[model samples]
Target: MRHLTQNWHVNILGFVLFLFTAVLLLIADNLSISYKEALTFYDEKNLLHYLSNLSVYFLGQSNIALRFPFILFYVLSVILMYKMTADYFKYESDRLISVLIFMFLPGIIGASLLVNNSIIVIFCTILYLYYYRTYNRHNYVLLFIFVFLDNSFAILFLALFFYAMKNRQNQLFIISLILFGLSMYIFGFDTFGKPKSHILDTFAIYASIFSPLLFLYFFYSMYRIGVKGKRSIYWYVSMTAFLFSFLLSFRQKIYIEDFAPFVVVTVPLMMKLFFHSLRVRLPRFRDKHYKVAALTLFLLFVNVGVILFNKPIYLMLKQSDDHFAYNYHFADEIAQLLQKSNIYTVTSNDYKLLKRLEFYGIHTDKKSTNFISIKPLNVYDKKFQIDYFNTNILNIYYVNLKK
Candidate 1:
C-alpha cells in the first residue's frame, strides 16, 4: 500500500499535467477558426499542398494527420521536464516549484496549445534536458529525427546540442554538423549561396534577440561545472559558438522550443543558488516572504492567465454576434455549387476563403493553393476555371475534381 501510494503520487503529477494541457489545447481549438485560418493563409497551406501531392516514397502522414502526434510529443515533453526537475532537485517543494514554473512559462504555455512548430520546440527542449540529465547519446538520435520532421529553423536546437558536445566528442560534433547540413538540403532548403531571401529569417533574427540575459549568467555558472580545468578551450569556444548562433538567429522567429536545451542546462547550475538563498532568508521571516512569494506567483500566473485565458474569452464574446453570418453564408453558397460537380482545380489569390474552408474541414478537389497578388488575377489556367471568385482579390473558387 505504501509503495502504491508512492507510485501513485509520482505518476499522478505527470498525469495531471497532461490532462491540464489537453484541456487548455481544446479550449484553443474550440474558440474559433482564426488561428488555424491564419496558419493555412500563411505557410501551412503550402505545406499541406506539398503533403497532398507528396511522392509515394515519403514516410510521413498528411498535414492534418500530424497535429495529434505533435500534441502528444508536447505532452511527453512536459512530463519529461517535470521528472527531470524532480530528479535534479530532490526536494519535493523545489520540484513542485519547477513544475509550476514550467507550466506557467510564458513561452511554453503559449506554444503548447497551438498546432505549429512551437510544439516541436517544446519537445526538443525537454528532450535535450532529459538527455543532459541522463548523459545519453541515444537521445541525440531522437533529436535528429525531430529536427528533420520539423521545419528548417528547428535546426537551431541541433546546433546548440552539437555546440555542447564539441568539447568532449569532436568527431560526434562534426558528424552532427554534417548531418544538419544534409538535413537542411534534403528537407527542401536550397544549399546554394543566398538560397532564399526570407529563409529562416524569423529564427535567424527576431527570436535570437529576445534570449534572456540568463545565457550570460549561465556562462558564469559553467565555471561551477568545473569545465575550466581540462576543457577550458572547448568550454569557451562552445560558449562563443552558441552565443554567435543566438546572435545570428536574432531576426528569425526561432521560438522558445529552439532555446529549450539552453534553458535545461541552467537548471543544475542555478538550482543550488536558488535554494541556498531561499533557505538562508526564508526561515527568518517566514510569513512575510511567503506572502510576497505568493503574490509574485499570482502576478506571473495572472500575466499568463491573460494570454492563455482572456484572449479566448474576448474572442468568444466577439464571435457570438456573427457566429453564422459570414462563414456559414460563404460555406453554404460554395458547398451548394460544388455539391454535385466533378471539379478538381481551384485558383485564387485570396488565402482567407481557402484557409477558412480548410479550417472548417471542408475538403474538396485539388486546390491550386497559390497566393493572389494585387497585380493581376489569373483565373483562366488550363487546369481550372473561375467557378467562384471575388473580383477584389480572387477570394475563392473551385476547379473540377474531389479531395
Candidate 2:
C-alpha cells in the first residue's frame, strides 16, 4: 500500500508538470515579438539567437516558434528544480512545495517566453548543482566545462570557489578559481554606465521577480542560514550571488540576470528553512508560520495569473507603452495587418520595429516608395485583438509614394 501511494504521488507530480507545460505553450502563443527580441532575432548571433533562427526556420516565424526553445528550457529547469528538491528536502510534501513555488515564480515564467538567456542560465545552473552534489569526483569536469557557456557563469564559478574554500574541497576550489579567471578574461565584466546607484530599483525588480512576499522570505532564509542553520553547497552559491549582486547595486545598476539564476534555485533552501521553522515551533506557535506561507503562496499564484492573463492589463494602462509588456506588442500585429493588404515591402522610422516585422514576412527596402510611420492613437484597431478586446496599441500609417 505504501509503494502504491508513492507511485500515486509521483503520478500527481507528472500530471502537474504536464499542465504547467500546457500553460506555458498558451502564454507563448499570446506573446508578440519585443524590440529586444527583434534585436536578438536579427542582430545577434549568440547561442539563443542561433537556436531561435533554427526553430523559426523549421516551424515558420511565429511567436510560438521563436519562444519554443525557451519554453523547453523552462521545462528542464522545472525538472531540475524537482531533482534538487528531492536532494535537499526529505519529505515528499516539502519537495512538491519547492517544485511548485519554482514553477510559479514570476521571473521563471517570464524568462520562459521571452528572447533572453535567463531560462537557459537557470537550467544550466541547477544542472550544475545536481551534478556537483551527486557526483563527487567528476564534478569539476563540468565545472571547467562551464567557462565557455556564458559570461553569467563567471558568477557561478565565483560562488563555487567560495564554497570550495569554506569546505576545503581543494579540487573544486582550484577548478572553479581557474574557470572564474578564464570566464572573466573572455567575458569581461561591464560595470560601465553603472556609476549611478539604483539600489531601490534593484530591490523593486527582485520583488517583482519573486513576488514581494516570497522575496521577503527568501531574504530571511539567507539570513537564517547565516545566523544559525547549517549551510550546504547550494546555500553558499545562492548567498554569494545574492551578496555580490546587491553589493554591486550599491555602486551601479547590476544586471539582475547575472545573479538571479543562481539565487532562484535556492527555493528549495527557502522551503527547507520554512518547514523547519514551522515544525520546530510548538503547535500553537506554528500559526504565524502557516499564515506567512499561505500569504506568500497567494501572492505567487496571483503573480502567475497576472502574467498568463496580461493582455487585459492593457485595458488598465493610460498609455500602451506604460504597460509592463509593452515592448512585446505592435510588431507582429502590424505586420499581419500589412500583409493582408499585400504590402510586403516598407521602411519604418522605427528601425527595431522594421526588423521585427521582417520575421513575419515583411522586409525593409530602403529607398522604396512605401513608408511606415506610427502615432499614439488611442483608437482601437479592429484588426488586432488581444483576447476578445482589441487594443489601441499603435496607430500605424503606410505612406505610398508610387507615382
Candidate 3:
C-alpha cells in the first residue's frame, strides 16, 4: 500500500481527476455570479470576494472566463483535503478514501462550482488546518491570510485557542484573538436581517447538501468515536463552528453555503471513524470478508444515490443552461444593438439583468456617455423621450439621455 501510494501515477491520477471536474464546472452554466452574490458584490458587503468580482471585470466581463480562477481554487481545495487527510491517517489507502469521499460529496461539488465565497472559505480553511497540524514558526502566516480573507474564519480561533492552552502557547493564543478582532472590525459582521425560527429547515438544508442518510450515518459514527486526545480538538472545534452557525441561523439566517468550511473540515475525521469502525467489527462474524464487502457496497450505494439525485445538482445543471440561454445566448444581439444605437450606458430596474449587461460590456453605468434607462417611468424621468423599446426575454430601451 505504501509503495502504491508513493507511485508517481497516484498523484497523476488525482490531478487528472481534478482536471476533469474543473473542466466540467467550467462548461457548466451559471458559473457566473448568481443574483444573491451579485447583490453582495454590488453592495460591497464582503471585500474578500472583491478579487472574484475583479477577475470578472478584468476578464473583459466574460462570465465563462471569470470561473477560471474559482475552478483553480476548487482544484487546490481538493489537493489540500488530500494532504490534510494523509496527515491524519498513516495509511495511503485511508487518505485516498478520504479524498475520494470529499471529491464525490454533493455538497463539496456544489460549493466548488458556485461563484461565491464558499469555495474561498473551504480552500483557506483546509490550507490553515494543514499548516496548523504541521505547526512551525512560519505557520502563523496562514493565520494572517485566513483572517484577511474572511471574517467568518474567525471561528478558527476557537480551535487555535484550545491548542494554545494545551501547549502553553499563551502568546500564540493572544495573537489569534487579536487577529480575530481585527477581522471582525475590518469585514464587519454579516447580518441577514432577523433570524428565522427555521431550525428544521436548516437541518434539512445540511441533509440535502450531505445527503440525509449519509449525514445520519456520519452523526452516528461521530457519536461512536467519542472525542478524545489532542487531535480530537480539531473535531470538537469544527463541530462547534457548525453548531454555532446552525444556531446563529435561528436569529440571522445563515445559508448552508456559509457552513461549507466547517463541513469540509469535519469530513476527514468522519471518514476516519468510518474506516476505523470497519476494521473493529463484531467477533461473531468469524468470516467478516463478505460482511465488510456488503457493508461497504451499501454505504457506497447510499452516497452515490444521494449525489445523483441531489436537488442542487439538478438545479445547477438546469440553471446553467437557462442562464446561458437567457443571458450569454443574447450577448451578440445586445452588443450589436448597443453598437448601432447612440447608447453608452443602460439602466435597468432588474439588478440581475443590469449585472448581466455589465458583464457583457454593455455599460450599465448611468454616468457613462449615451446613457439610456430601461426602467419604467417611475425610475427614469418622464421627460427623457423613449427612442426605442423592445420587450422580449430581456427588456431593452433606447432613451434620449438629453431632456
Candidate 4:
C-alpha cells in the first residue's frame, strides 16, 4: 500500500510535468526574439547557435522551433531531478515536492525557453550528479567531456576538487584541477571591465532566480551545511559556484548564467535541510519553520506566475522601456506592422533588431537602401499600437530611404 501511494505520487508529478511542458511551448510561441538572441542567431556562433539552426531547419523558423531544444533539455532535467531527490529524501511525497519545485523555478523556467546554454548546463549538471551517485566511476569520463562544453563547468571541476580533497581522493582532485585549468584557458575569464561593484545587482538577479525569501533560505541552507551538516558532493558543487560568483562580482560582474545552474540544482539539499530542522523541533515549536516554508512556497508560485504572465507587468511599469522584458517583447509586432506597410528587405540602425526581424522574413539588402529607426512609445498613441494585449505597448516606427 505504501508502494502504491509512492507510485501514485510519482505518477501525479508526471502529469504535472506534461502540463508544464505545454505551458512552456505556449510561452515560447508568444515571446519575440530578443536582441541578445538575435545576435546569437546571426553574429555569434556556438553549440546553441547550431542546435537552434537545426531545429528551425526541420520545424521552420518559428519561436517554438527556436526554443524546442532547450524545452526538451528542461524535461530531461526534471526527470534527473526526480531521480536525484531519492538521494536526500526518505518520503516519496518529499521527493515529489522537491522535483515539483525544481520544475517551476523562475530561473529554470526562463532558461528552458530562451536561446542560451542555461537549460543545457542545468541538464548536464543534473545528469552528472545522477551519474556520479549511481555509477561513481564513469563520472570522470563525463567530467572530461564537460571541459570543451562551457566555461561554466570550471565551477563544477573546482567544486569536485574540494570534495576530492575532503575524501582524500588524490586522483580525483588532480584531475579536477587540470580540468578547471582547461576550462579557464578555453573560455578566457574576462577581466576587461574596470573593476567596480555589481554584487548588489548579482544579489537582485539571484533573488529573481530563486525568488526572494527562498533565496535567503537557500543561502542559509548552504551556510548551515558548510558549518555543521554533512557536506556532500552536491552541496560542494552548489556552494563553490555560489561563493565563486558572488566573490568575483566584487571585482567584475560575473555571468550569473554560468553559476545559477549549479546553485539551483541544490534544491534537494535545501529541502533536506528544511525538513530535518523542522522534524528536530518539537511539534508546537515548529510553527516558525512551517510559516516560513509556507511563505517561501507562496513567493515561489508568485514569482513563477509573474514570469509566465508577464504581459500584465507592462501596465505597472512607469515606462515601457523600464519593463524588464522590453527587449524580448517588440520585434515580432514590429515586423508585422512593416509587412502590412509593404516594407520588405529593409535595413536598420538597430543591428540586433534587424537580425530578429530577418528571422520573421524581413530580409535586408544594402542595395535596397530602406532604413528603419525604432522607438518605443510609452504613452497612448493612435499610430501603431500592436500586439495581443491590444494596448499601447508599441508606437509607430518611421521608415526612411538613404540619400
Model 3 agreement with the true structure over 265-318: per-residue lDDT tens digits: 677777777666666877565356456545754665576554433333333442
**Candidate 3 wrong stretches, greater than 4 Å:** 1-16, 28-32, 36-50, 53-60, 135-138, 166-169, 227-231, 282-348, 365-403
Candidate 2 local lDDT, 1-403, one digit each (tens): 8887876746677898899889888778767888778788888888878989999999888899999999999988888777756556768887887888888899999889888888988998888778766665436666676777678889888887888898898987888888899999999875646377778888998898899999998999999888898888788888898888888988887788888888888888888888887888899998887888889889888988988887777777777778788777767778888888888998757787787788788899998777776653343223333232655545676666664
Over all chains combined, what TM-score does candidate 4 have? 0.93
TM-score of each: 0.56, 0.93, 0.70, 0.93
Which ten-residue region of model 3 has the weakest summed lDDT?
382-391
Please tell me which predicted candidate would have the highest lDDT against the true structure. 4
Clash totals for all candidate models: 25, 0, 3, 0
What tens digits encode model 4's per-residue C-alpha lDDT throughout 1-403? 8886659977898899999999999999989998788777777788888888889999998989989999999999999889866656777778888889889899999999899888999999999989877776537888888888888998899999999999999999899999999999999765435699889989999999999998998999999989998999999999999998889989887779989999999999988887788898899999998888899999999999989888888866667778877788878887888788787887656777787888898987766666666564343222456544665665655545543
lDDT of 1: 0.46
Compared with the true structure, what per-residue lDDT tens digits does model 1 show for residues 26-95?
A: 6444333343534543455454334322421253322333244445555676677666665656566676
> Candidate 4 local accuracy as lDDT?
0.85
State each model's C-alpha RMSD to the native: 9.6, 2.7, 7.1, 2.7
Q: Is candidate 1 or candidate 4 better by TM-score?
A: 4
The C-alpha stretches of model 2 lying farther than 4 A from their native spots are 1-4, 376-391
Query: Comparing candidate 3 with candidate 4, which one achieves the higher lDDT?
Result: 4
lDDT-best of 2 and 4: 4
